[model samples]
Target chain A: MEIKETFGLMARHTDDVIVVCALGMSANEWWQVTGSEDTFYMHGAMGFASSFALGLAVAMPDKQVWIIDGDGSLCMNLGTLLTASGQGPANLKHFVLNNGVYQTVGGVPMTGASRSSYTAIAAGAGVERCYTADSMNALSAVLADIKKPGHCFIDLQVERDDGPILAPPQPFEGPEMKYRFGRAMERRFGIEVFGPEGY
Target chain B: MSNPTVHDQLVAALKRCDVGLAASLPDDWITPTLQRLDREPGIAHIRVAREAEAVAAASGAFFAGARSVAVMGATGLFTCLGELATLNLRHQIPLFMLVSERGSRDDHRIYQEVQGRRIKPVLESLDFPYFRITSTADIEELPHAYEWCRMQKRPVIGFLARKLLKG
Candidate 1:
């Protein structure tokens, strides 16, 4: 599915209890999906999100940690996959928006026309389950099937020609949106984001 | 007031800094300090599975925003160098290490004595700032060193000589 469609589906389905770690996407889209008022974004620190997410996921095991990553960003720290799998988290979902380019920094080709195989790599790390979606329909279908208790990767392969989408540039601080995400999810689904399992 | 002992001072400073996690392999020089740290109520002194695991656990504690210190003999400190380079230097994470020095003793027949002598030089080669604590008075820097490490976003090593901990 297209990036926009995947985001819309996530927004609709996410009860807000899931802490979406948004990184390496177009700035505007990243902010919108995260809707995080005050939080750290990689911004320029592309490869570090997964590392941070790994730490956060293990620390806050009760929270459903979702990582919104790009294929290029994943390639930057692929070793993180081994670390992630080493500490199995049933609640973490890793999403890779693979448009075959570093779309934010001038749409540079990432793999020199060679399709990156992240799903295979994730599966090899013992992620339990993995999926790749190259079209909007396939992306929607995968989102419909996100049952937890394992890690999930949705590689959303969009057209390289998708136009530029600009997000706000203000840096966030603290966990205001983290609280909002919890409140939003709790209001809708009666589940605590930072539950008793982790504080 | 001017002097107590290295064991007393390190234990007191670690309590003041609210250090909740500590791990170490045994050593004669650090043995008394380890014993004192073990009796402290606030600190959770853990006997680590290994020095490498101790470093990894310290990184975990740092991420949780807890003050964690790993204690080891001078010999094991050499072995933990790789972990320091990976988790502290490369990642800019702060880890406080207290390494107990070993002096010339008959038991030095083991490989650890050779490693003990090489600790400071290896740390220098890797550019990790270190301090030598020969007397209880030198222990005053413990808290300050921890604060500096947090502020600087790096690791700090305290090399406690045998005389200091023995007293």
Candidate 2:
């Protein structure tokens, strides 16, 4: 399936889930598909988005959290799968956009992409609900299961689109992004993300 | 204070700061404290495979309106400098880390020498603020340090001195 099509399918499945996007292609494409202020688009931290999403899931046990990760990012921190599995937060869902290359850095081929099985790796890491979808219909078929409880992993094999990238990122700086995300959380969940003095 | 007392005091201070979650990768110096955190009923302790995972996890917990901390050794902290710069620094997320202050005169570990000699200078170059905790009295300041980290909107390192941990 095409990367855009994969994102479209995932976007349609997003209900009230808060998304965390890895830097580069995942963040850019997610912004294109969903102009969401609720999502935390990582501009840095190449491989730790999954860990960040895991933390959020643990903190808000009642809320569902999804991380849109890339293969390069996943390879950078494969231990995250182990950590996620060990913690096993029931509200967390991990999805990897595997295109066999680093889509953001001018399509450089990623290591072990062709031969590696991310689902098998996640399964070995103790994530029991592991799925792989290579086509739009396959992805659509697994949408319902994605929303189900328990720590889950999905490897979406997509064809890298050489087309022009759409959706410019939010213009806000780092601190502004923090406040925006925190405020959105407070507004949505009626929780105090910041103190009374607004630290 | 004895070694166990210091651990008790540190954990109590974390509780006083309202830290509900802790993410950690163990080092010998901080192992006692991590054990204490693991046993604390009110705090959820997450054992991670890498130090950067702990850092990122604690950063994410902040957005969920949760106060959290990351614990690691000095060498582990060195391994996570890139993630610290990109994730915590780039995002202006406040992450409170309790790191074992290794490579001091009392610490004879040769592998830790580079971390001891270079960690502070690197943190200085990155503009990250840190404080050294040396004794039981210093444990009381953790809550204040935690508040300062949030106000600063950056990662703050609280270095637990070898002397204190050895108690």
Candidate 3:
């Protein structure tokens, strides 16, 4: 099972409330895998997917929220791991594809990056438990262990490199999507998007 | 007796750094601090929809030649984690984070404590340094923290004690 296949299976299980944010290389693979133009937010701004996922999870507790991230990307926002742990959102699942390098930016080797033990970091951050996988079978088995009413952090150790991949051509939808998102969040969280007066 | 209130000390410390943009989402605890920050004409305080959005906006502001910071609660810090690590850490961008302390074991609410204690450890795991402040006495170090961030080209966080904010 390729990484893309893994995403497809996860997508099938996700409902409308589940929000996905893909960053860096994973974003490149994910936009294609899900073919979900709107389902994922290709945060051109790296390291923010987890944070955004947290917001969506808190706002829509009933929905299953997913984050497709890269090791380099996750390392950049490593603080988020701890933050996410503390939030303890049962419906959120964080999948980090660790290629042992910044695969998106020239595939440069990250110093002691892989040896950094993200699983330990996740567990220490209060994730309860975390899983790591390189092959699809392992991934499916670990993902199966992710029970509901808890957060799952999966660190996927993939090949050090993937061939050339292009970002989605369609520019990310503008403020309109934000408005819709805000409305949906407001409905779920019962808080106005921009407060009582609206922004 | 102190010459300035805790709020005044914070404002002075921020002013000393010549901070331009103060971005945040409103919280009852930090409302007074936000209002005080707004009073400084030298600082432009902008309210963002989300805590992470404020961090991103601050990143943009820094690139555009502005020194900026975002105000948020301890829990809001969790929400802004991606930006704190990515834009701020990966790119070596400096965005000051002023977070309100909450969810300690003694706190009145059970709201976000489950995850609140994890904030410090998260910062540690990320290898980012932060300063925890409890009163006006700590104002003198703001410039040093700001300068170090300038030199290192990364984000530095300042956690304000709950009592200080309550006052």
Predicted structure with the largest DockQ when compared to the true one: 2
lDDT string for model 1 (B30-134, tens) is 778789887887775555434654565455445434577878877777766765775466555667888876533423546666775566778889888878777
- Ranked by TM-score, the better of candidates 1 and 3 is 1
Off by over 4 Å in 3: A162-199, B1-167
The predictions' CA RMSDs to the true structure, in order, are 9.4, 1.8, 13.5
**Clashing pairs for predicted structure model 3, backbone only:** A76-B85, A86-B115
**Higher-ranked by lDDT: 1 or 3:** 3
| Per-prediction TM-score | 0.55, 0.96, 0.54
Please give the ranking of all candidate structures by DockQ, highest first, separated by commas.
2, 1, 3
Over 4 Å off in model 2, which ranges? A162-167, B1-4
TM-score of 1: 0.55
Ranking by TM-score: 2, 1, 3
Assess candidate 2 and give its TM-score to the true structure: 0.96
Residue pairs with clashing backbones, model 2: none
lDDT of 2 by residue, B107-164 (tens): 9989989899999999999999999999878898889999999988888999999889
Query: What is the CAPRI rating of model 3's predicted complex?
Result: incorrect
TM-scores of chain A in all candidate models: 0.75, 0.94, 0.80
